[model samples]
Target: MNQFNKTINRLGTYCTQWDFVKDRFGKDDVLPFTISDMDISTSPEILLALQKRVDHGIFGYTRWNHPDFKNAIISWYQKRFDCPIQDSWIAYTPSVIYGIVKVLSVYNPQKKPICFITPCYDGFMKILSSNDYPTKTVHQSLDNGVYNLDWNELETALSQSKVFLLCNPNNPNGYVWSVEDLTKIIELCKKHKVIIVSDDIHMDFVYKPALFTPIIKVAQKMDYLDNVVIITSSAKTFNLSSLGGAYIICPNITKLAEYVYLLGNKDSLSSAPALFITSLITGYTQSEAWTDELIEYCHQNLIFVKEYLEKHLPTLSVTIPEGTYFAWVDCSKLGIPMSEIQDKLLNIGKVAIMDGDRYEESAPFLRMIIACPRSKVEDGLKRLVKSLL
Candidate 1:
């Protein structure tokens, strides 16, 4: 009954999430459930807008401060997330990951190690190691399928570490940190002289009844705004990762501006696709109907996954995702080593899922991307369960 079905094509699209891992798994046909992006077709309005821009036939260089581009982003953030912003705080980067790297390079950590909560995104470790920065991880507790932050442990890490890289609505686990929790974390950081690096790229995909609270907002209220640096982008929400439009949100405008100038900023210019996405996101922000529907659909998908697991794979515990479309399934009951389970999934079931050990200390867990269509989710789950059996 959905009108969005016509544009959903698995062919001719060249999705790295699905295509790239096919041969690696030694599968003739891969049922990849690895990456986070949804298999569902993008919003028609977004595609049309991008197409129209392409039809214009002018592919000239564009600036990030273009009136429409800047206004679109500003208007969208204010309307969607209640993140009030000044024009001066917005600085463009090629990607959110790139912005994170800049924070590592610019911030003088001295002797203090950078701390991130463990069972985190695997790439963060790679980033830290690549930069040669020492990292200390605070492991979260596993309670009733939900991952809970050990506040005391977190504080201990923050006290010793200089930079705390926080993932809001945290990745792999999908636990949305409450405002009160964030306030406490900021207070601890303030007490410890810790600089906060908040990655809030998944802020927009939050399901209702659970809100995505920006750490910066809480930091600002606590007069700890100067200690915070936020990196976010519309790429994840708008399905425009290739567009390469992202911003670093920090209140110390003069510091960032001087830093950019010092670095001889070369790639700050936004592209045509970025402009198109900004325009598309502007409309989406103004009209919540699409996002509302999307959230509802995602929540239903989560419910479906939970119910499916309970009935078929009773031993596999899954945390009902508070935000984002990822379901972290605890696979300890199967008695197989994490590597063996991953191998079985790829070779036997033709399924490619993210291994648990990648998140650090989550060895018996399986991260499933539940962002695809319900039919695809069902197929993946069936294949996974069959592989386990």
Candidate 2:
């Protein structure tokens, strides 16, 4: 086990995933695989940077003109994904969800619709719902063990909508869209005049043999640069999500600048720790060997979970994930209603997996976060198997 592998009993130390769930499930103890955050601690380099910022003791307002911050990001993209990104296109925001809301509010469709893929992050639906904006979905196609996009359905939906939201390496299914596939999506969107907001938050966690192809890269090559908007964060990769730093990389310089001037609120200035975390993007570039090791560990953890379920709980099945540490388990075999399954999992199994109802099209599949210590994953699955048995 790597150093980050250990039981998280100190979870009561302000961990919302652990503490907040007690009241929700009416149990003092519940294994929380529900929330998207990992139980694994942040990288030690990230912790040291955060602690340094704390040690400074000022906590003053911060800005993002730092060359190192920008360079780190640039280097990360260039070195890791081989996607060269210009420093000028980066737009700052506290969170991608909030950024999406802001973009929707500004783009403010009157008759045109704002669309989200079904069984998405759920938070995306909530954001649009709270604003009472009409939306549409492109249901995913499940063939045997893999999930894929329904191009005809997607084309149809885009033909009717103005703004389309895309989750690269999708949430529940972990389906990483290929460049060719993303090209099709962009072609459809362009035909319909749909502006694409691509959330690549999970871009950094892609497992090999399933490389992540950013929509920006595809759009640039297709010269549809004006049609795409990329939203990404170090939060997901670095586990500094709570530190609140998100960015939008757009090539429509004139429009993006206009946006900056119009809505350049205090939120645009990323926090010190957030900037620091961005600085640590260099670590990934510099520590490819280390990242390779982590990726190997994650791959092993995924294999362990799949094999355990297949061997011990043959009835339960998980779609072997292509990206992200989340395992989308089809609980339909349990013969339980989606909500009822969630309740039993949390209250009886004492294991908290994300509910399927959130992803409307993929209802009855629990989203299990496997980005934790191997032991925790094993124990959680053991509890899961026992409860189901």
Candidate 3:
């Protein structure tokens, strides 16, 4: 049997996806396809590693600067994305967003605003709003279903921005950025002298034939290495999010030291996670096959969603994402307002999925997390169809 075929229940586990569905959708009974985390179990090899750490039973204050763990990340990037980095470029943060926030702490947003292509991750919006940071929202041109960068607009935004916060394999839509796009973006940022802070947490989920061009590679190629900061986590790929580990890859030696000193001394969040480090060691060394199998499973899952939606609810379109195990579903063909659609999905269908509005999209779409067992995918699709019909 396929490993993905195995089922597990997360209810009563206090999982935000299951136990606290009401906190998001305001309905306790709805089946949630909302959170980005997978409902399926993670790699067995990773589980074993965590179990071994648990058996050791000495969970004291830990450090993250060992070469073994750093080399694990380096090797994975080299093998997976053909991206190379050294131990000096790595720094530890508890989460990707935390690393971004730390980077932001060093720059003044008032002089030049942060710029990013929208419909972007809502977390980006929240961070800007909370901090009162100036920002420029570059709108990507949506053609048929895919989103393409508007170079002229992007250039304009970059001119006035200090930083470009990039979401590779952009959330809510899973558009794996092409090499050309990465090159052009690096060129623009270089031209404007703007720093790029790339959050590539979804790099592993990129589908085949559509490559995930790590921005760091482009930066290195363009000799713009010092201006780029690569922030990513193993949490998403290994389902080790609850383990709380993330790292930053800053090639600028001076800035890398600054991040370590500040995030460690000032922020007090630079300590390593014992289990998270162990999982990375074992998962990276042992779970290559498991991850490959997962990618194939998720690729097929994305296909199944598109096919099922087409067959049952023709008007509801699912944009076949080039990466990530998410379905960017469009219900605009129904001509129903987004609010009404959201209401029906919650109140009537009892299917809780995230609305695109969360990602600041103008379209009435739902970003469904399809990285679960096939049964849940079908169940959510049926419920969604029931809502509209």
Candidate 4:
């Protein structure tokens, strides 16, 4: 068995994924597959690094300007994606969402509308809504189980919008954007003079043959890097979301400085914890093998899900994800209401999965997190079969 197959007990760690399911759904026996975080243990190198930090016992204010941290990020990008990132272009933020919020605030001085592909990360819509920023959601059309960008719609939306928030290797559906598609997007954004903020936290989760083209790479290739900013972290790749450290990579030095200036003025912005920075460095530098194994394991889980659904639940269809551990299962064929599906899964099936409508309202889908032990995934599938079949 792979190390990722070992089920670490996360019940009492205040882990919202497992521990809070009972309170949230009023059920003690529910097996939660919601939330993007993994149930697997973190990389051993990360654990050792944290151990060393704890042994020191001095949790003082740490600077984000550490050469080790920046160098690790720089090396990881260059090695993994063949993308070049500079130290000066990087700026730290507490999380990807926080970085995005700062970008919106800094760029949209007139508060012009923001646009993004729909069935996206729900947080993007929520954050924009909370800030009273109007948004144009360009829903991706599904063709033969793969989602593609509607170029005409996107161009139109970009023409009217001030900012375009992109989710490369998009959340929920897990479609890794191709370089060609990304190039077209960059060209369109350039034509419309729209600023691009790409949330690429899922870049590393892509499956084989489906490359994750970072926006910066595409922009650099086109020599139009001035308008793009990338928000990413070790959080998703290493399951370190709780540790709280994400960074923004802005190619334009002047715009990067503006973001730094605005973020500096915010009294509420807190620096990442020492442990988080240590984990980032360890993950970027020494966790490549562990990550590769984890992705392979997840690919097997993806295959298992595709096969199981085809055999046991022939009426339903699943979008075979090119990236990420999520299986976005389409239940529209059943003609059941989304709420009823959620109710049955939570109460009858005793399995916790995210309602698909949360990503796009009225979409007959359920997002299942498959980054757990195979036994656990089998259990969830069995429960799903019992509830819906």
Root-mean-square deviation (CA) per prediction: 2.3, 2.2, 1.2, 1.4
Ranking by TM-score: 3, 4, 2, 1
Residue 388 displacement in candidate 2 (angstroms): 1.1
What are the per-residue Cα lDDT tens digits for candidate 3 across 1-389? 88797778999888999999998988899999988899888799888878888999999988889988889988998888898888899888888888888787665435458998787788898888788778998776455676776789889988998999999988878888888888988898888889999989998998879988888888888999989998998888888888898999999898888788888888787778888889887877788899999999999999999999889899988778898878988888899899999899998889999988889889787889989999899899889989998
Give candidate 4's whole-model lDDT.
0.87
lDDT (10s digit) by residue, model 2, range 1-389: 57656656746567667878775456667887767777766666656666776777776576665676667778778877888888888767667886777666555547367776777888888887888877888778555586766788878877888889899888877888887788888888778888888998888778878899888888888878886888888777766667776777878787567556544553444444444444355455454565666667677888888899999988778767778878878777778787776666776778877776767755577778887889889988988887777
Candidate 4 TM-score, true structure as reference = 0.97
Which tens-of-lDDT digit does each residue in 268-381 have in candidate 4?
A: 454558988999999889999999999999999989988998899876788679998898888888898988887888777899888877887356888999998998999999
lDDT of each: 0.75, 0.74, 0.86, 0.87
Q: In terms of TM-score, which candidate is strongest?
A: 3
TM-score per prediction, in order, is 0.92, 0.93, 0.98, 0.97
Error of 3 at 349 (Å): 1.5
Which residue pairs collide, candidate 4? none
Candidate 2 clashes between residue pairs 3 or more apart in a chain or in different chains: 119-359
Between candidates 3 and 4, name the one with more favorable TM-score.
3
